[model samples]
Target chain A: MTERLNEDQPIFIQIAELIETSIVEGDRLANEQVPSTNEFAKHYQINPATAAKGINLLVDQGILFKKRGVGMFVTEDAKQIILAKRQERFYTHYVQPLLQEAKRISLTQEQLLDFIKEGFSHED
Target chain B: MKISATDLNKIYKKEQALNHLSLTLEGNKIIGLLGKNGAGKTTLMRLIAGHFQPTSGQLEINGQSPFNHYSITRDVCLIQENYNFYEKFTIDDILKISAVFYPNWNASEAEELVTLFKLKRKRKISALSKGMLSAVGIIVGLASHSPITIFDEPYIGLDASYRSTFYDLLLQSYQEDPRLIILSTHLIDEVSKLFEEVAILHDGKLLLHEKAEDLAENHCIVSGPVKEVDKAIEGKQVLHQSTLLGQKTAILYDQEIDGNYDSLTFSKASIQELFVYLTKEEVVKHGDRN
Candidate 1:
């Protein structure tokens, strides 16, 4: 069976999110070369057109830059840009879900806040 | 290359194989033909390849019927699961014959595929394993370079790694040269990523033909407490539903799901899951009519 990059979303979106995370995590630093569309297609076993679509998402966000005859490279402010975009998504993608789950189990707001603080204190 | 099937009907004696099926496909792109067994996938492929005559209506490739038409037939190649070769012929001999059949056949590419598949060139067709036979079929289908190529369950016995290799080569070759490629397989999840469009046949009729990405985006699954799930999917097209005790999950189609729910979680369904749900709806509809 083909391996899924992420089972919850479309492959192109997953591809874009994957690179965005890598940039935010500093695994792919600014000015470092990113894989070409063909490389991404082969690595993910997806169509090259789909891979191009994913890469284009980053290009549209100004997170990846393309040089003539050379492969794509991370923009100088790619990490910052990704951080900003992800922060915008953080509320819906993480915070809302967290609150919803907390409500589902009848956890009080103060209790949830205390748990979060306790959790952060133990973080390395 | 353009393939048009209008009100196409195929009847095999007493059984109806295709029912007024109509579809128009143009341009060079990969299309996945997905359906349950005996859903007229083979019938459609055979009709397009000129192996079977339609009982009614029409199917034309480039404005000409593919049946016994040498000019159009040469441009269309269909490789079925049980592809036949001379039992005594070696792989090399078969490749030589294929070159004559497919004018644009690439011998070097075939050689490369043979090496990748680790097949002995001189091995007789009868001596190869099932997986090796499937690999040979994939090699010919890819190396043929036909304008419109159809593969019906091409990777039957291929292992996961070999299957991934085939997918890689297929994408690479398609990037190099775009063509109208149709693939019919039950392994929808494995190959859905490569398809630009997907056509589903159900009960000998054209069920759906949608862009693969749009189909995935158009449907979603909502799961949680029975009451919340029911309320969330109210008035929507629920393709399938499963319930256990107080929890329930329903797959909804053509609905925009947003907002945060206290007890419900929404998730996207895989192509295979969507197929099952969609076709299951058809089954339930038929049952209701009965």
Candidate 2:
């Protein structure tokens, strides 16, 4: 479950998010091997070094553990840990901005409802 | 372990291809060599690879000359866009030749790539398509495991999916063995991400040689108001400034961008946009005595 990222944050951060999302979504389970840095680089069409940096971020965070001769594997509690972390980030990073912008535009509950209704009417 | 070229000069028919350009190409990185058709990119790569004798300059490969020397040539494989192969030789023949040339040649790896690329081993060199030819070139360049692999133009007649596969393969190979890779191509945006360091050549001169991310970070388009942008870029390295309908976008060169300018915010410059801006004709150099 590779995550789709915007061109905003540095790519390595998005790569970490990608692995975390995979674990939380059950796409990547505990003890499963993750793609190597070069694999990720080729898959994402990014620099191999940048890919390694992204994977290393997860390793440093304890969400992933390297097996030396083997490959990188997800930690046991990676799913739950990522879920809680992402949930908090979602609200503060994404939700708050929408609420603040809506408030700034002076859109009340009723007005927003009416606006939605008008948009729906024009679509069909 | 960076590949550094000092006072690189190439003179051909009274026209200097490389005008004493000096650049320190970083190691363990993919560098995007961006330039026009006649720019000194090919010349620079050839000079570094020892394809031709330099008029008066020095190129050290990890501090060595790769020209006409088997020792350096074994560790450095240079592939140009139009590769010259024996027309009668098949893919197997090519592999045999590679075995004699590249000491790090992995036969199994070559076989695996042949299957991955769907290239037939029995096909003649003259009969291969442009895409297939490029694929063979990629296989050789990747499997050579050279310390420095310079690809003049890796993508020729390759479809989108094939090109994507090429990028993936290049990255996958580099992770196992980090080496200096230089790619000269007109398709700047497609391969810009793989570039750790980027060199912009214009009219036989090395215009810019900076880290890929740093190059993007160092310059930005500031557009809002003529007076506002002018004041915003005060004491900054203004690369180029243009006005439209009383609004001006001054392309400023700065190192650190906090991105909280009151008049206008700064966005990262795309490698392609920066190359165009840096190499545009009539644009004065940093300090032109004339």
Candidate 3:
């Protein structure tokens, strides 16, 4: 289920990220018809123009394509494109923050690496 | 339609309702008219709807005064919280009357909304529950399709599910017919995302009118060591601050937010939080003057 928007960022950017997550999670497959802006606006209780802007951002990124008079669809390589994009942002979005948080708690790099190895060895 | 209010002032007996309020808006966009109770939101909407004239200022819709102007008034619609209807009138009667008054009224849309709200045509206005009455107002507001539509606390008794439904329908209606829509309500957090821009009122005066996203991006709350937080926000406009056990948190409204805070954690300020801080600032300043 889609959660209500948070105050951290603009709704349009969040909408774009929501769609990207759907693609990356295999919920929205490549070449599949994605929800239209109207559908998104109604579902999210947001302005239609804002939803359109989010879709347009994805279209500009070649992850989604608009079929005139029909609706938007994920590109054939949408999942791959999203994966690559997220990989490029991993350091800034997750890894750097993780390391900083570790440093704040006085956890060294070697200790963090060991923890990661232990977690991988024992799956919940 | 272009709606312009210049140096608008409204006085109710000895009380000043609106004080030199000036605003100029054109094009079609959703504007969140937000303020505390008795902050002159109703007065402003009434003036725009021509229900009441400004005591000393000019209010025009499409370059013509709305007061006593049949065409201009017809183009504007203001749905107030307390909807006054003939007590004997049924839901169907109300919709029929509205269809005759509003030039852009959509009968099919009204019928659809009535069904969606589970409103029975034979039910009298006086007998409906508060939520049902609010639903009636929502139906009229959405189906009217006026050039300028203002809703003043239109969802007083609506449930959360119904409120969300209303928001969805509002967006769909707006997309179908682009118009200047102003919503005045205290449910800022719930409806903030739906607004393109917001106009904040405080003490009967316009405090701020800006893009919703831009305002959120510029304002933030930072918490960290007192010295580090103060040093990071030096020379910036701070709205509020608190200190506890050598830790401090400050709300800052700076357009050029320097995200280089090495020792502090920052988060964007919610619209509701900004509204509270801004409105409270006025009270503090007023108390100081007294």
Going through the candidates in the order shown, the clash numbers are: 0, 1, 0
Expressed as tens digits, the lDDT of each residue in B179-230 for candidate 2 is 8888889988788888878888888778888876567556677787788777
Tens-digit lDDT track of model 1 for B93-207: 9899999999889899999999999999999999988899999999999999999999999887889999889888888888888999998999988999888889999988988
| Cα lDDT of model 3 by residue, A19-91, tens digit | 9998898888888888888888778887777788888999999999988998999999888888999999998
Local error of candidate 1 at B53, Å?
Answer: 2.6
RMSD (CA, Å), each prediction:
3.2, 5.5, 2.9
Residue lDDT tens for model 3, B54-96:
8998888888888888889998888988765677999999999
Report the Cα lDDT for residue A77, model 1. 88
lDDT at residue A34 of model 1 (Cα atoms): 83
Worst-scoring 10-residue span by lDDT in model 3 chain B: B281-290
Question: Taking the tens digit of each residue's C-alpha lDDT, what string does model 2 give over A87-107?
Answer: 888886665565666787987
Better of 1 and 2 by TM-score: 1
TM-score of chain A of each: 0.91, 0.78, 0.91
lDDT of each: 0.87, 0.79, 0.87
